[model samples]
Target: MRFARHRTDQGPRLAVLDDEDALIDLDTEPDLPALLAHDGRLRSAGEVALRTRRRVTPWAGADLMAPLDPPTVRDFSTFPEHTAGVVKMLDPDAEIPAEFWEIPAFYFSNPYATVGPHDDVEIPPGCALFDFELEVAAVVGAAGRDLGVEDAADHLAGFVVLNDFSARDVQFHEMRMRLGPAKGKDTATALGAVFVTADELADRRSGPSYDLAMEVRVNGELIGQDRLDNMAWSFAALATYASRGTWIRPGDLLGSGTCQGGCLAELWGRHGRDHLPPLRPGDVVTTSVELLGGTRNRVVPGPPRHEILPWRRP
Candidate 1:
């Protein structure tokens, strides 16, 4: 089952995407066990909407807010290519630390992250290079920890496409701490357009895996493409490792890092192939995952609307 939040003339509402028709009033479905006790209509309507598909608008609606606005997003360095390219991309020609090999690593994003489809992202003026990453990320539905390998999958709620935008210049220059990969990555992150529930994909375990074609276009020109099934680690395993001790609650987001050849950083850092070109004002970057959905963000040069300049007169 695919879940989506949209806006209608009637105000913001959650709808279930049923191909052509969307099941209405599904806003409270996720909190079913609790909502049902207080609001019967919400429960009844949700059930009806899921039972059958009806003629409805194509999941498109007014602006879509972040599915988990107050979300806890953690990015994991799960892929091997990412590990190998780190030294060259950042430290280059520097001595290798003995602790080069580790299980995996991650960082957190503010939960109040809010952005939507087609929103214009203001690129920081001093930044020279801007890049995009395509990944499949999941939202945590339940809480669990020290969970056995067999009970892993149950903790997942759904999945969505995550665009981990990076600033190559800042990253290489600022991160002397050897921890960050942060200076480059902290600029912005794109999630949403839609989230497909785990049930939508079959047999998540036995994938070689399935290669759903992926593509990224800058200013409408194609730049990246490949399959997700080829990744070194699967989503289930990533979640299990991440939730080892801490409680992963509802609304926490976990990113699948950049997929194979998934972003400019991964490809260029390894092959010395000019992976990063640079992002300028008025650039429209779009990324798509096969059998799922596509999300696009535009680059605008300026400060965010909410940011007040220091010299703006007291």
Candidate 2:
């Protein structure tokens, strides 16, 4: 079943898509996270809501919001091609870390900074090289600890298109000290208007992920396109790795990182920075995935950076 969270007079309300492609308001359920937490309630609840047809809104007109405010976001670098492209860009002769092939690597991102699929994103303060990451995110439906790859897939609730916005300059600068991609990435992340259940993608299953077409556009011009099947690490492996010493909780989000050629930095590496400039204040970035829908975000200006005293050498 496809679900969404949309704005209403009361607040954000959960809705399920009917056969007609209209949103049937699930008046009782508050949001996707709440519905998923009820274990064994999603299908019945959605079915009942569809039957009642309490309030049906045209999908095109509904004011969509992010499916849920995730408790934690683990953005995993699951595509070796993307990693290799980026590593080559950073240092042409440098080889990818061997450990990357052995285990899935991920970074925690700010959950509170998430924005709705259609919301506007602000350029990070003092950021000159703004970019967008086209990726898919799996929302955890159940909780588990130290799960194996086989057991991990069972915990998935659904999938949503994720755009992990970045500030290349800030990211590179901080990573130079080998500590961060924090401030550069924490500014914004755009989630979905449509959340598709695991069953919806069952037929398209290829290898570990679905054979979904992923694309990114800037100002209506297609910049990157790839298949989700290109990911080296499966979502289950990522989830299992994430649960190695920690717990995976309901409402937690796991991003599949950037697809190959999904960001300007990668394109710049292949082409040139001069050929493709960084995002500007009014630039629009749209990322889409098959079945999961898409997110359209406009870039806007942010506050200027506040300078602080530098550390003094002893």
Candidate 3:
């Protein structure tokens, strides 16, 4: 079943999409996280909502919110093509680190920075090279620790399209210190208007991931495209690795990092820095993944940068 959280006069309400594509209100839970916290609640509630057309709202006019305010957001670089492209861009002769191939590496992102599908994203302070990453995210439905790859799949609740907005200039500068991608990435991350249940995608299963087409556009022009099946690691592998020595709980989000050519950085690497300019105020960016749906965000300006104290030598 397809689920969504949308704004209503009462507040944000959980909803399920009916066969006609209309949203049927699921009043038992306020949001997806609440529903998923209880075992089997999502399926049971979804079934009941579909059976009794309690309150139906047209999907076209509903005001959508991010499916849930995730407790944690872990983004993984599981696509070798994107990883290799970025490595080459940084150093033409540099090879992908052997560790990248052996482990499912990820970085924790600020969950507080999440925005809704149609919301406007602000360009980080002092940022000139703002970019967007097109990817898919898995939402955790169950709690588990140190899970194996096979057991991890059962803990997945659903999938959503994720946009990991970035500030390239700030990112590279921090990485030079071998420390962060912090403020450069924490500014914004947009999620779905639709959260698709894992079972719904059974037919598209290919290898370790669903054979879904993914794409991104800026100002109505297609800039990048790829398939989800291209990942070097599967969602289950990522989840299992994440659970190592930690707890994977309901509402946690795991992002399949930028798909092949899914960001302007990759295009910049392949072509030139000036080939496709960075996002500017009023520029619209739309990222879509098959079945999971998409998000359309407009760029906006942020506060001016404030200087911090300069580093002092001891």
Candidate 4:
């Protein structure tokens, strides 16, 4: 089932997309995770909406919020092509990290700063090379630990389109410190308005991957595209690794890192920095994963560079 959250005069409302593409207001909880905690309650709510046909809102005019505000976000770099592409751009002489092949690596990111479909993302101050990483994120529905791939799949509640926005300049500098992506990534991360249940995507499963077409468009121009099938490490495997030694609770978000050619970082690394310009104020970005949904966001100017100046020793 396709689920969503929309803003209303009252507050954020949980909703389910009907067969007719209308949003049936579940109105039980404010977000997806809360509803997910109720077991089969979400599906039952969908059934009631279809039968009653009352309070059904048209999908066109609804204000979509991020499908889920996960408690935590674990973003994994599982696409070799993206890493390889990045290496080609950053330093052709450098080889892809052997650790990436040896183990699944991920970083914890801010969950509080998530934006929804049609939301406006403010470019972080001092960021001139703004970029977007197109990805698919799995929403954990149940708690588990030390799970196998198949068991991890069972723990997944659903999937959503994710856009990991980045400030390339900040990211590059911070990584040199060998610690964070903190300021570079914490600023903004966008998710699609709709969340598709795992069962809904069962038919699309191939091995441990989904046969989905993922793409991103900037100002109506298609800039990047890739197939989920291309992921070297499956989502299940990543989740399994993340769940090790700790409990993965409901509402945790696990992301498949940037797809091949999914961001300007790799693109500029490949072609030439002069070839593609960074995202700027008023630019629109649309990222989508087939069957999940799409998120369209407009870029807005941030604070003056000086206003957000980072700390430095005197």
Whole-model lDDT, candidate 3? 0.91
Tell how far residue 269 is off in model 3, in angstroms: 1.6
Highest-scoring model, lDDT: 3
Task: State the lDDT of candidate 2 residue by residue for 223-280, as single tens digits.
Answer: 9999999999999998899899989898899999999989988877656677688999
Q: Model 4: runs farther than 4 Å from truth?
A: 306-314
Q: Is 2 or 3 the stronger prediction by lDDT?
A: 3
Model 3: colliding residue pairs: none
Residue-pair clashes per candidate: 1, 0, 0, 1
TM-score of structure candidate 4:
0.95
Instruction: Score candidate 2 by TM-score against the native.
Output: 0.97
lDDT (Cα, tens digit) per residue for candidate 3, span 30-131: 667878889999889989988897888899989999988999999999988898777766777767789988998998999999999999999999999999
Report residue 123 deviation for candidate 1 (angstroms): 0.8
- Rank list by TM-score: 3, 2, 4, 1
Q: By TM-score, is 1 or 2 better?
A: 2
TM-score of 1: 0.79
Please list the residue runs of candidate 2 whose C-alpha ends up more than 4 Å from where it truly belongs after superposition: none
**Per-prediction TM-score to the true structure, in the order listed:** 0.79, 0.97, 0.97, 0.95
| Candidates by lDDT, descending order | 3, 2, 4, 1
- Compared with the true structure, what per-residue lDDT tens digits does model 4 show for residues 163-272? 99999998888988988888899788999888888888888887658999999999999999999888888888988999998988888899989999899998888788
